[model samples]
Target: MSAAGSGPEDLARGVLEGGARSIGRAISEVERDSVTVPAILRRVFPRTGRARIIGITGPPGAGKSTLVQRLAQAYRRAGRRVGIVAVDPSSPFTGGAILGDRIRMSEIYTDPGVFIRSMATRGALGGLARATSDAVDVLDAAGFDPILIETVGVGQDEVDIVRAADTIAVVLVPGLGDDIQAIKAGILEIADVFVVNKAEREGADRAVAELSMMLDLAGHPEWRPPIVKTSAPSGSGVPEAVAALEAHGAHLAASGEGRRRRSLRARSRLLALLETRFRRAIEARAPEPDGLEQAVAAVAERREDPYSAAARLFEELVPPPREAAERRSG
Candidate 1:
């Protein structure tokens, strides 16, 4: 499809037909937050929810890209179309991804049944791009099953993957100095399955033992996260990791956690959309010289406090409820 004349409906139709070009274009629009996004999403929303989203996240050097490639291969062997969304670190100058994951995953680049998209974090926190979830929705609408989301090797606080994936597999390596303590607070609790990649190393078993002990101490009565040892390069224990992920998927479905998670995801998406729209509205109302610009100047000059300026801007942008009702009625 030509990019020039393609309307949202045309793009949405192409996406639903599983055309790779259409999928790519749709995702680009999402990343750019284009004006056509709402129309395209409205058209394609019905076709989503069929894909089982899996999130893979851990610290740097955990070999997440290779492991994602392995998991994609395994799912392909099962005769499923796989979509991989690899969130890569943004380049400081260009604001584009370093694209290292694409290079590392070049082995599967030619696979006909696999679709891969690498997104830049673009200063968004939580180890994901702001547009990552929308891109997953596009892939889902395009008929890809079992989508795998590999987060930028994240720190303790970047656990937003929990709200985006049905199953989360936290990857860890043996020698990552105090693996348990590194992720104990934020990342550990989000794991449905823990993968100890590079298990051929000397301390692999010890890492597994420590993770197990942590799980025991956490005392998850509903479902304790399973630890899987994997060597991504050698392809050992990957199938077991896949199996553990599937088991957690099953548990989520059987125990009704899946529904709860979907609800939470829906809420998060709605709130994010609302925030974006409100910001846009505020920006539209606050033009240069006499609006937000003047307010900022006042605050910077110490003539007005930030809180007071913000309140004034909000009031100007959004009138009181009674005044809004009167305006509407008038």
Candidate 2:
């Protein structure tokens, strides 16, 4: 389809046709503008509720990709359509498998019921791939039963998929000194499930204990998100891990938590889109050259207070909250 005729509905139709190339092109546009993603999402919204969105994240060398591959296999074995987003290091995005080797997931790739895509944080993209979330929706709309998002075990900043996913599995391994400390805030605080992958490793037990204790202290209301230990390579503990994940999914679906969780995700996504749009509008209207550098220089020279300078910029961009009411009344 030409650019002029390609609207979100067209993309949605393309996605439903199982045309991976069309889906990839659709995601590129969504990534460029967060708002554009929501437009496609709106068209595919109802169709999306059918898939189970699973996010896997952890620190480097934690075996997240391998575990995701295994998990995809397990789901496919049970006669389900599975979609996977393999997120890898930025370097691999330039050449090698940032998303890991297609070979790792090669088993399920030819299953006819499984679909996979690779995404990475590259170049000026410091965060997760902007298309990651959009691609998930596309897969969801395409009738994939479970969409597995496997992100490289980076720190908090890269774990943004936790926000976009329906259920999150924070994968970890033993022998890492500050594993818990590294994942404390944005990532750990939001985990719906935890996987201690490479469970055969020496300190794997210790790592599981530490994480379990933290989860107990936090006190989730209906269910304590289970911690599953797994040796993804050897296939040990894979069954229990799969069972626990499945049970957690059922619980969410039955207890109305799924609806609540999705509502929260949608709200977060909408606000993020709004902020991105507002920033772009402000930047386009009042372009600031070397804006951050100018602010730093002003502070270093004591010509302006940093806090006041930030406030000045806010005033330049955002009108008083009542501007909306005025627009409505006008």
Candidate 3:
């Protein structure tokens, strides 16, 4: 733990120097929701913003893991250090990460320049573990150039997790009828690049055509998501997909969208932190044990509605001005 004699400051320094053990431990701290995460991030924040965060998401059976493996290899070959956070579905019994994705990428498991971590979604609806952004920060501080986040393959809600990425690639495959239409209104809106994986399949061309039509109907903006066809096993179109990713990065830099995206990420992180702190504070000041049980019982019996109970709790925590004034006068 970072909280040992050397402390979070030491851990942060190790992370900045790209110590592999330190990076792994730091990410573990974040995953465990340690109290030291904020302190560690404070020390390493300056070293961040250097890594380009890329998010990969899609429906199940989209071959996302295979595509991610190929992309990581391409980046490594190009001399870029890659950090991969593979968000996997949680094991129902243990609440731990399922290692299927990691197992699929076994070939690159030992690569020195590539670091991969499999995280369980832990019931988060966004297809990402709650600690995902924090894990990315740890990787960034460790000087990973291109950080990749692979979401659990939940179609519509995948966008929430990938919003943290500088460029989001939505992976889709052929022969999945109506999949495009199902996700078009949500994840499609967040994509900077659309990937047609298993493009050699029968309906691959039709899938591409449908995506093109959707992009057209969405109204041509200054930055249109480019669709890249990829057949991962054969390494087909992998380079082109990488090129599209790089192009989007270039576009973000040239158009100043990168700064805007960073700002949004910062704002969202701050709000989440604030919400967490506020909840903790309220919990610390929770009603007396018996009172709490009574309240719960009331709600369970439907004698007191949850909404009204919540309002009462809020008022008790932060008294209304009128009540405070009356108390002062009295």
C-alpha lDDT score of every prediction, in listed order: 0.81, 0.72, 0.79
TM, every model: 0.88, 0.79, 0.84
- Which candidate do you rate higher for lDDT, 2 or 3? 3
Ranking by TM-score: 1, 3, 2
Q: lDDT by residue for model 2 over 129-240, one digit each (tens)?
A: 4467677878888778788887765555466665567788888787665757865865787677888888888988888888888878888878887888899877777888
Please list the Cα RMSD from the true structure of every candidate, rounded to 1 decimal place: 3.8, 4.2, 4.7
Candidate 3 Cα deviation (angstroms), residue 206: 1.2
Which ranges in model 3 have alpha carbons more than 4 Å from their true place? Answer: 1-6, 90-107, 123-129, 153-157, 287-308, 318-330
| Model 1 CA deviation exceeding 4 Å by range | 1-5, 90-107, 123-128, 287-290, 323-330
Residue 271: error of model 3 in Å? Answer: 1.5
Q: Among these predicted structures, which one has the highest TM-score?
A: 1
State residue 122's C-alpha deviation in candidate 3, in Å: 2.9
Judged by whole-model lDDT over C-alpha atoms, candidate 2 comes out at 0.72
lDDT of 1: 0.81
Q: Write the residue-wise lDDT of candidate 3 on 262-296 in tens digits.
A: 99888977787777776676677757763455667
